[model samples]
Target: MATRTASCSCGQLRIEVNGEPLGVGVCHCLSCQQRTGSVFAALAAFRTPYTVTGEAREYLRTGDQGGRFLFRFCPVCGTNLFHTEEDVGDRSVAVAVGGFADPSFPPPEASVYDCRRHGWVVLPADVTVYDKDPE
Candidate 1:
């Protein structure tokens, strides 16, 4: 199994994960844009056995549909690192793809929140796109 390591912008927070990811997706929701300060956010989800080291501050926010998610960020650089889905159980969490800083990590399997994506944004032809959350 290949182990992947990622860290925050300031290198204060580090994460290591081995094995395949449950899913990979890109989200263009308003919240993602605001949090990442970019056009969208991409993440890879894995189930347990992932290790996170260093001080990370967490922020919990209610979602668009009233669900809640927990976001973890580096206290020093304020870099978003990971988040947990409210209903994904305690063993599963998603890591920010950019934190890896690996150009060849993996592309998003699905493009979500297309409705909120910028008009000029373009995506690959093979990626599944969802206007909303792919119901």
Candidate 2:
């Protein structure tokens, strides 16, 4: 199993996953843009059994589709680290790709909310694009 560790900028919060992500994607939704302070938010979803070290602050936000997402960030540096669907069992977790700080990390497999993506940004032709969240 290939393990990957992701941490906050201040190194106060860290997550360790024992295997490759179940999926890797990028979100161009307005909320994701605001949350990441970037054009898009890149994330890698992994199954349960991961480990978290250090405390974090959480913010709950409702998506455009009415799904509630609980975002966790480093309390010390305010770096958004991971998030999960509220009320759902611990099946998976989505961690911010930037936290890995690894250039070799896998590329995003999908791009969601493409309608909100910046006109200047271009993704690889291999990436599957969705105007909105895929069903």
Candidate 3:
């Protein structure tokens, strides 16, 4: 199995995961836009056994689904590195796909909160779109 590495903007926080992620998705919720400073956020979910190094600050907030989620970011650069949704269980952590800094990283398979997406934003036809978190 191959491994992938992801890091914070300032390189202060880093993590390594073996093999492919359990899932990859995109979110267009208002909270995601504020956190990413973009219209949407794309993430890859990995379970335990991944190695993490460096320091990060945790920010817990209510999710779009009314559930609480924890976001981890680098203190120095304030990079939104990863987050964990209450529905996804504690064993899995979802890291921003852009943190890998790889253009060829797997494309998002599912897109949620599509109602919050911008009019100008366009997604591939192959990707599944949900008006809200289908879960």
lDDT of each: 0.89, 0.95, 0.89
Residue-wise lDDT of candidate 1 within 1-135, one digit each (tens)?
A: 888888999998998888878888999999999999999999999878889999999999887767689999999999999988776578888999999899988788899999999999888888999889754
RMSD of each: 1.2, 0.8, 1.3
Q: How far does residue 127 in candidate 3 sit from its true spot (Å)? A: 0.6
List TM-score per model, in order: 0.94, 0.97, 0.93
Candidates sorted by TM-score, best first: 2, 1, 3
Task: Give candidate 1 misplaced runs (Cα > 4 Å).
Answer: none
**Model 1, residue 26: displacement in angstroms?**
0.8
State the number of backbone clashes in model 1: 0
Q: Of the candidates shown, which would achieve the greatest TM-score relative to the real structure?
A: 2
Q: Alpha carbon lDDT of residue 65, candidate 2?
A: 81
The local lDDT score (0 to 100) that residue 74 gets in candidate 1 is 96
Positional deviation of residue 23's Cα in model 1 after best superposition, in angstroms: 1.8
Model 1 reaches what TM-score against the true structure? 0.94
Candidate 3 minimal-lDDT segment of 10 residues: 83-92
lDDT of 2 by residue, 37-67 (tens): 9999999999998899999999999988888
Clashing pairs in 1: none
